[model samples]
Target: MAGAADAATTLVGRVLAGRSGALANRLDLAGIRTKPQDFAFLIGVLAVAVLAATLLLGAGWLSVIAAAASPVVAMLFLNIRIARRRDAFATQLDGTLQLLASSLRAGYSTMQALGSVAQQSEEPSASELARIVNEARIGRPVVAALEEAADRMASEDFHWTAQAIAINREVGGSLAETLDGVAHTIRERGQIRRQVKTLSSEGRLSAVILMALPFGVAGFLMIINPAYLAPLFASGLGIAMLAGGAVLMVVGGIWLYKTVEIKF
Candidate 1:
């Protein structure tokens, strides 16, 4: 049984890692404290709950469909968490950059400034910087550490700043001035991002409401008129229709989300 469990974990890990290790990278970027095993366990539990719910409803095909979708749902939740954390980190980034520049101007080394950021800032930047500082402490190259963090955060501007620092270290330049400029750019971009978000708020909200409408109506009907939608759950064709409608709804949601999401 232990061997079987271990094999299951290995298989799940490989499946999650995928061809590009994108899931692993996302998990890292999200700064989820749980291990992969824990994540897999939680997903399994949710899958089992879904399976149980469908079974209780006497909807075999629906049960299978729900079971199949369980992992996707879990991944979506993880992605949401990662997004929220990254948003928070982005909010903190300008201040972090400014602090690092100030430290440099105050005669601190790059590592010293990073260490201060690690110690002083709030998460997820503090945690990210602390990881970088820890890596450097273990004799890894600081630039490499910064680059790795940038990649993990999926921050292009941060990556550019990292590259600038790397070049400065190799060619000799005013590090403080470079960092100050980067900080200014980051702040300006953040301001623009806020403006865009504000301008698009109505569309974003409408998208969310539209996405939730079907589910909300279904839930309401379940309470007020289960008999009305009973056929939709009773027949095999109904199950298939439900599955297809779910797929279409997911696709539409993605399309709407992409339409509203403005990147600067």
Candidate 2:
């Protein structure tokens, strides 16, 4: 049981490590540690496979193959969702900092600017800054409040600003000017990223279609041909090949993804 718990911990630890903002960090603030959802995710993965095979067992060989592959599909979808959300949150980081800088220039104190941002910014950022302001109003130190805010949002861009604020309070410098520079830099970087994404959209789409076409056809074949696809899963060698093929497809997709994703 300890080993199982350890494994689960490791899985969630990886996810949490990959995350920093409102979703994961709030758990720490609320005295909550790791989430049961981590273990649930593992179970969900296994369950997807089991349920698919069971449901399609007597269908066609192609049907069983499709069912067996459902787990991989489900996990891929889950991963895409997580990645998209993380990307969106990261994309918003620069804007959030720009908003903070603008508010500061408008005569708002840091805390007040954050509070106003909480009231106006979109979800996740709004949800997070509101927490920071609330925590400060309850008497948390300004630095701690700001740290908590950074730790919660956890974007590279946002964290840089947070570090500036936290470090500035101790050593002191022109914080607003520093933040203004940072915001401008972020805006420029974001524009370049947007252009890269636009330029790479065709390649990304090709990758998606290339990856999905085979599986989609296999599913359609299973609906039409049962005997033809049966031997592939009934034998161990076939199962290995099936798994290998699936892995190859994933690897290819990842390669295409990286090819198109221009990192700045």
Candidate 3:
């Protein structure tokens, strides 16, 4: 029995690592340790949520389906958090590069410049740089360490900078000059990104309002005239329509998001 249970657990772990391993990487970028523990915690929460919905809320089959999808919802929430933190870190990167460049020009080695970045920069940037520095201190290749951080944070800018550093290390160019140019490019890109965001603010706001309109109206109707919406929840056809609407809403939301999200 113990052997069978161990085999089952191993199979589950393999499936999760194969399918949802990116979640572990996102948690790392968001500064959360204990990826395995967090995954187990999320699964436990999902189980509790499903049980409560079934027993307390008297949920039907549709609700059970939704409950089963709770892990995906939790992952989406976690991805949002990771994206926001990564954006914050990106905003800090240009300054970090500039600082590193200054340190390089002041006669510091690559490793020393990274130490300065860890000391002077703010979170995500500081922590990430510190991680690279620590890895290099432990005998890992510095370029590989930087690239690993860049990959985890999903930052092309940092990846490019790492490439430049690697090239400089091989060809023996002025490292400070290369970093300065990368810093300048990153700063300009950030400015352009901010301008684009500002220009699209109205469209983004309109999309939000449009998406919320149906839910708000439905809620108001439920409060004012419960019988008016009763069939929607009570009848099979109404339930099917609700599900269809939900799927359409999700599709439309993704489309709208893509339309407005201009990437640099």
The lDDT leader among the candidates is: 1
Output the better candidate (1/3) by TM-score.
3
Candidate 2 off by > 4 Å: 1-82, 135-154, 170-174
Q: Estimate each model's TM-score.
A: 0.82, 0.65, 0.84
- Residue 86's lDDT in candidate 1: 78
Q: Which tens-of-lDDT digit does each residue in 93-185 have in candidate 1?
A: 888888898898899999999999789899899999999989999999999998988887778878978988999999998898888888888
In candidate 2, the residue pairs with backbone N, CA or C atoms under 3 Å apart (3 or more residues apart, or in different chains) clash, namely: 21-152
Q: How many backbone overlaps does candidate 3 show?
A: 0
Number of the candidate with higher lDDT, 2 or 3:
3
Comparing candidate 1 with candidate 3, which one achieves the higher lDDT?
A: 1
TM-score of 2: 0.65
- RMSD in angstroms, all models? 3.3, 7.1, 3.8
Please write out the lDDT profile of model 3 over residues 1-264, one tens digit for every residue.
778655655665666776556666667766777555446555756766786777577666656677777877777777887898888889888888889989999999999999987999998898999999999999999999999998878999999999999999999989999999998888888889889999999989988988999999998998999899989889899999999999999999998898888777
Candidate 1 runs further than 4 Å off: 1-24, 53-68
Task: List candidate 3 stretches off by more than 4 Å.
Answer: 1-21, 46-66
lDDT of 3: 0.84
Candidate closest to the true structure, highest TM-score: 3
lDDT accuracy of residue 225 in candidate 1:
83
